[model samples]
Target: MLTITNVTWLDLLCLTGVGVYLVKQVLIKKNPAPYPPGPRGWPLIGNVLDMPRIKPWLTFAEWGQKYGDITHIEVLGRHIIVLNSTKTALKMMDSKSTFYSGRPVIPMVGELVGWKDSLPFLPYGDRFRQQRKNLHRVIGSRAAADVYNEIEEVETRRFLKRVLAKPDQLQEHIRHTAGAIILCISHGYEVKENNDPFIDLADRAVFNLSQATVLGAFMVDILPFMVKVPVWFHGAGFKRTARKWRETLEEMVSAPHKLVKDQMVAGTAPVSFTSTLLEGSHVSAEEDHAVKWSAFSLYAGGADATVSATYSFFLAMTLFPDVQKKAQAEIDAVVGPDRLPTFADRDSLPYTEALVKEVLRWNVVVPTGFAHCVTEDDIHDGYYIPKGTLIMPNIWFMLNDSRTYANPEQFNPERFLAKNGKEPETEPRTMCFGFGRRICPGVSNSHQLTNSLHLANAAIWISIAMSLAAFDISKVVENGVEITPEVEPLPGTISHPKPFKCSISPRSATVLELIEQDANHLVHDNTL
Candidate 1:
């Protein structure tokens, strides 16, 4: 019925094409589910300006209160899905792991700093699976409990000696202890001093990586093409920084690996993760590459996280003197003051064990836990989640969920205790380590003990029990005034208590004598 004589045939064809495109768009919109609700943002920027650079987890948690458990936001058109509840995270990240375990590509952290090789940032694929297998074979929960038990005990004793000698440098001593343990297990290398060069290099590299991966920290991360800009160009300092970071990262990954290889050739290699993997008869060059990077991954992030948790334990003790007193009382009743607490005393010291779990919950390390990306488009609870969407489990929110724990902000270990005053029925490891395939490989190795109270938690549990039995972490007294330590933690991916002053003193002369005896025995045994 339309008259086409007034218009050219080409123009009519164009009009018809436009009509078809509009109809298709409408059909497509009607077919797909809607994205999860989030704060509306302007076009193009898409919540980029609204994203908090520091302690973003808090913001996400607050948003979860307004929105549902699953909240979606976009940063410069990149889809971000935050899981605020344990149930949702478990369902999505754990039950549907295959479709949700991919790691988002961070140009600055992955491409520039060379962290793409690390297992934590590696994409979900065959290589990632192989690396995980190798890591689990060495440091998995069962393996860590079996092989590293005695080593953890010796290292804990050495750590006590360092703390006894320099109580003022408690955090430093904790760092040294964690570094020593990981170095020994990963490369069969001993960290003889707190200032070991390898430790220094690893620390610097991790710091750089953490800074680079902060959301919205680097422009190039969002605008990947900016990486092509010359280093000399104005505002291209990020390029220069990345180059320097690459050097440190390369050394962190390769230096210790080369050392192990050299020792293997010289017939002096110790039985370590690297040596075991390298000595295997069927190991290929590809497998060697996987092992090398996998081992370094253990050494790179392990020490810092351990140190952070330890510091949090100290901070908790300082703030809650009553909690400290209760834990110490339990340790005394179970282990007695004759010797330091050991793995053998774990079962008898239920309250002390509860304290360790509480510390992990109080100030979660890696709050918005390592982001997992989706491998394909999926519908979750009627909400459409497109492929490559970044999925972050709000660990802090889950740990502090008021529905799960009453008075969530208070530092209380009693929440974990069973109604009958027995061991905790439910451990917090699920929330602490993470969910599904992307869960921390070191979860079982990092914490959580078998019924035997093995080495997995020996470093932290023993240190905590022994320290409580030996020292009183009280408010610092300057002159006659008591300076209350602040309980607030610093905002970061791995949060630690802000610098706080507290007095660490032996409980009594008898306790000091016991500490001295233990130190003498460690030195006599050449364990330190």
Candidate 2:
């Protein structure tokens, strides 16, 4: 009996030891793999607590100082690797694009909105391939040139009219003008004058889309099984909002699509993208999903970016009037007072080109360029990134790096110009469009269109340069003390300046007559 009891006691003690070891392994240990260094964050919620609800860029930049070029954090089981430097970003995201080109499989967004098959945000695969090919056909460099003059004319005239009418709402005026150009080109619809239906529809769609990307939109993203549960027990609010977004988005897309379809049936539709896509002779019958996803891609890609660029133009103009003055002088010298600047005189206006490059680098619209996912286990700088990891190119950090740009915060267009005894190894274009095979295909065309808009704006700037030239652009005061102004951003993937007050007036009537004559010619047949 004593021997049997001893054996039983020994077995019990061994069992307890094993249990302790297992518990320690499961709960009290660090992650075995060597991940990139980042700040110590709480369990299950990583650097998310460090991020801001708005202007997360500032926080990310702060973190970059401590963590060096590449920082890694796990947010609720999601491995987010932020590329904080240009060399690392280009080396990994660009050089190894095939291994890191897929987008993070955003569960709620991918399943409901058909992002699983969309071009810009789709995972790297056959669906993405087909959609990208089709989009390239429509908005690629050569094709973009075809629509350049129309976009330039429409945006310029619309912006001028808005500035003339509602000088107080300059930011909104730029937004409306930019949104109108993208809508007109993407679909056959144009937003005219003030509060046009087309503008309202596009604006609503942009807002809804922003809601979908919000960090807390869908809790199901953090817990996958929630998707299997009933909607009432899950992200019920997200589901409802997503449906509303889908409806509003469909309204914007369907209007133009319906027109194209009706015109095609009656044989009168113009040669717009929607009309051409409807013909359906080019795409394979098996690839119907590609067609639908591509339509959404058009709206997503076109609207937010142009608006952000235009907003940057205004901010740059206000902060650095000397740059504006130089650009305007160049425009006047090339085009003369007899006529407004045209695309034909682009090369002659190098200062204007430099200004555009500076604008792109100064305030990047998409600070963290679209996140790309690692499709396969990759080795970078001796670090092993597991397959399915989320890789972010924190591009704003790169653009603002002092190593690349002198006095990075200041708006200096002359940095782009090749001055005497100075050589820039990397061109200004390197940071603007994007990196790698996914570089914005519409860049060349957008560059030209932006230049034309800038020239016309230069003329406008010259016309009114002296009038509002000395006008103070400082924040408004309440009760005699200068109030600390809040920086407002439009709620979307693209961040633009929020509305504020600035004074505007013509320097002289002589300059105003030139603007009036230019507006008349623009309003005529040559405009669109």
Candidate 3:
């Protein structure tokens, strides 16, 4: 009887183990929803080899055409969802923003290079909200137009002078102008020259950060366990690079902020974004920290983006002289040649306004809208999207959709104009800025002021109008040969036209005189 009981007990234990295995299998098969269709990739690597190192957006756009608006792929176990259509992006990133606002953890850029504090890469959480709130408080659409208009105007006038002095270095002048504007507004520290230390450090930091963020650039980003390896270990060059980058990033964030605080203490700080935040009523330590990083974030990307758009404008002007002529005509009729274009003149130049929209759409600054992360498992259009998926909105694909804009590839501003020859009822702000809660906080300020018709648009608009009003951009003539400018843009997250030669000359001696007059007499109230 004892032997029989022992055998029975052993059998029962074996049966129990089998029962658990069967139950697990059932659970796994219960919710087997199909993943969104994508190009067939290798087993293990799973599209890792298929990813493009440069201009990945172009490939993603092509895939969107083949696989549909919502395409999914995997790279070494990580899920990536590309939203190709504006309608789908709005539905997911806009309508269900809460679930899609989370940012993916970029080990190389965010963790190694120490950019986690930057608002752009911050994950969806209380800290992100705090940083964003502080950013909006200082530079929000309403506050920017009211507070930073003078600085923008003064810097832009300086820009005109720089371009007038050296027409060949138009790109350099635009970059310097962008840097100067952000520096003045953010730190109350004027950029004395094009090679200001602050600007140099910031530029270096941005360049390194951009390179690091490129997918597949660093092996550790794909296999995060490699982060545990020592810097002295073999094949660990990225670790040393990250260390140097971190130091530069820290100085970029802290140095200017410290200067503003020191100036405030000396009672000589200029009225600026940092000054306002630091001197605000009843500020706590946490809030002050938030403000410092938020201000740094603004200075970091603001100039780069503005520079790219302006460069595109120059490219557009060179390629399409007709657009330039019409725009100049409009600017002359509204502001005239005596004075440069101003924010108040924005409304009067409808064609100029349409040109701004066209520039944004023609070659978007960020073709792939910054990636967002999924916080929880979700399903859309009968496709399964697991939690922690990386979401990339293909802004290039959506902007170039032929259905939405007729002849999308053509650089025509009339697409944004109505039948009545006025601004269209619906503009493509979403394509330019992004979607949902993670949308660019600076979009409002970048485009225009709130509820102000005088300045239908913001700094870029004023700069473009004034540029057209003042200068005639045409093809460069070398040895009696008209060098046709190529409109091909460099490949990166923030793209600009490849270096092209163009002849930029004042429309008239009167325009040059006006630029000089404004440059000399523009009063900058640096006093707080």
Candidate 4:
């Protein structure tokens, strides 16, 4: 009934969108090859209603069980291919990485929340390559990663002190230490023992990120055009929320950068990833922006994974006392209680090293990984994968796949150690950090176990080793009843173990001296 004169721009836009949607569906061409098998979805909406809202990796694993490894589905005319096995993910993402490395257009987190500038969300192009180059200069290899070993030792020793002082607040201490170490390495700014502004800002922004990146949480992600709607419009509350989060994200990204720049101007900026990069003769705007976000990405890269894995290590120790005792024995045999374990002692403590691997495998920090957008149309494994298809890897299921590990659910460090005639299971590093070009810049793809200490989590390894040597982690006895924590990880893009009580105390009265060993000094000076 409305004529052009009566039609508002919003009305016209909605009409055009509906027309386009219908036409696109009607004009769809036949496929060259059949899609990989998946549960059948209804017409028009396709699998929109079938998408799992919580713990999607478990659902993806079921699809894998029924339909084989590579399962495919369509939502709103878009292709979403899920990989349930390491073999399929590696074959395509590794072999055909040229196009498989592209990132999907995440409207909520990427565009609206302003994380599109981040390395993980950047599409495969010059900008992505430039950012990768920046990260590689600092942590490209294990040797490159080792340059910050001093930082790791200092922060970890501090972590041990905080843990001894307040054992019940273990998670807080782990997060604080991770933030301190990453901040020092990324921006050369040290965190205060009490509340620090940058850390607080980052924590808020990161929690927002965890909420924002959840698949299907925001409708704008599924329908990109929704971003065009006004914030005041009904059902546009997500727009306002995204705007607030974006502001927090921008502050977190820019504040430390401005500090580094100010220090550089005053000639007092200590050596750091940001300081080192901005030391150039002349800086362009694009390069400066890349440096700012990449440095934030460094903290983002390390803090969550480190905190999750380290906390899970404590949880595993609480539940599996025999494993804890065995690891303690290994630490005791290799490095005496008189001195704390150092990175130099890592190789000597193979059992502890295996324990670290088990921590990564068991916790499964990132369950369902970031989706890789296919940049070109192609055929893979007899499947017709078109351009713009999002390939999601089910990392949790892959790590837990019964075919790969002996008892996937059990917290057994011995799985990695070869005994009587059996070799260790497949190295989970290949699956955990991701595959191909989009692999996390923090982790090393090295074939050696010693080099498994990623630039992001090398501190985690040292912290675990030092903690085992310095303290005894066990179940808490309350009201004469020992509390055994459950094996459950919270749902999110980055999974964290549910809070559980545990007892942490010095192994002996003498170990207190080791905890107070001037963490700010020693290790850094020896290397310097």
**Candidate with the greatest lDDT versus the true structure:** 4
lDDT of each residue in 1-528, candidate 3, tens digit only? 444324442343344435544655576554458899998876445676777777888899889989999988877667899988988998998788889999888888889999988888888888898877766655554544456667678888888888888988988788778778777877888897667898888887877876787766787776676688788766678999999999999999999999998898899988877898778588788887888898887765467777778888998999999999999888888886688888778678888988988998887877887789999888887889888999998888788888677888898888877877554533666566677777665554222423431111366776787788888999998999999988786755667789999998888988878877746466676443
Better of 1 and 3 by lDDT: 3
lDDT of 4 by residue, 132-213 (tens): 8888877776777778888888888899999988998999999998898888888999899989999888888877877888
Q: Per-prediction RMSD in angstroms?
A: 7.8, 8.7, 8.5, 3.2
Descending-TM-score candidate ranking: 4, 3, 1, 2
Write one digit per residue (lDDT tens) for candidate 2, span 396-510: 7788889888888887778877789886424445655556555543343223443323222232222222222222233345678754434466654556666545444443454
Number of the candidate with higher TM-score, 2 or 3: 3
lDDT of every predicted structure (CA atoms):
0.77, 0.60, 0.78, 0.85
Model 4: CA > 4 A from native: 1-21, 446-453, 523-528
lDDT of 3 at 186: 76
lDDT of 2 at 131: 67
The deviation in Å at residue 249 for candidate 2 is 2.0
Better of 1 and 2 by lDDT: 1
Least lDDT summed over 10 consecutive residues: which range in candidate 1? 519-528
1-528 in candidate 1: lDDT tens per residue?
Answer: 555335443443345445545655676454289999888865445676678887888899988998889998876557899888988988898789889989988889898878898998999888998988887776565544456756666777777767778888987788778777778888888786657998788778877866777777887776676678788765678989999999999998889999999999899988888888888587778988999998887765466677777888888888898999888888888877687777677778888888998888887877888888999999999999998899988899999998777788898898888867555534666777677887765554222335323222446676777778778888888999999878776755667778877788888888778767644243211121
After TM-score superposition, what is the CA distance of residue 461 in candidate 2 from its true location, in Å?
A: 14
Model 4 RMSD to the real structure? 3.2
Question: Candidate 2, overall lDDT?
Answer: 0.60
Query: Which pairs of residues collide in candidate 3?
Result: none
Candidate 1: stretches off by over 4 Å: 1-31, 420-426, 445-458, 517-528
Question: What C-alpha lDDT, on a 0 to 100 scale, does residue 121 get in candidate 2?
Answer: 64
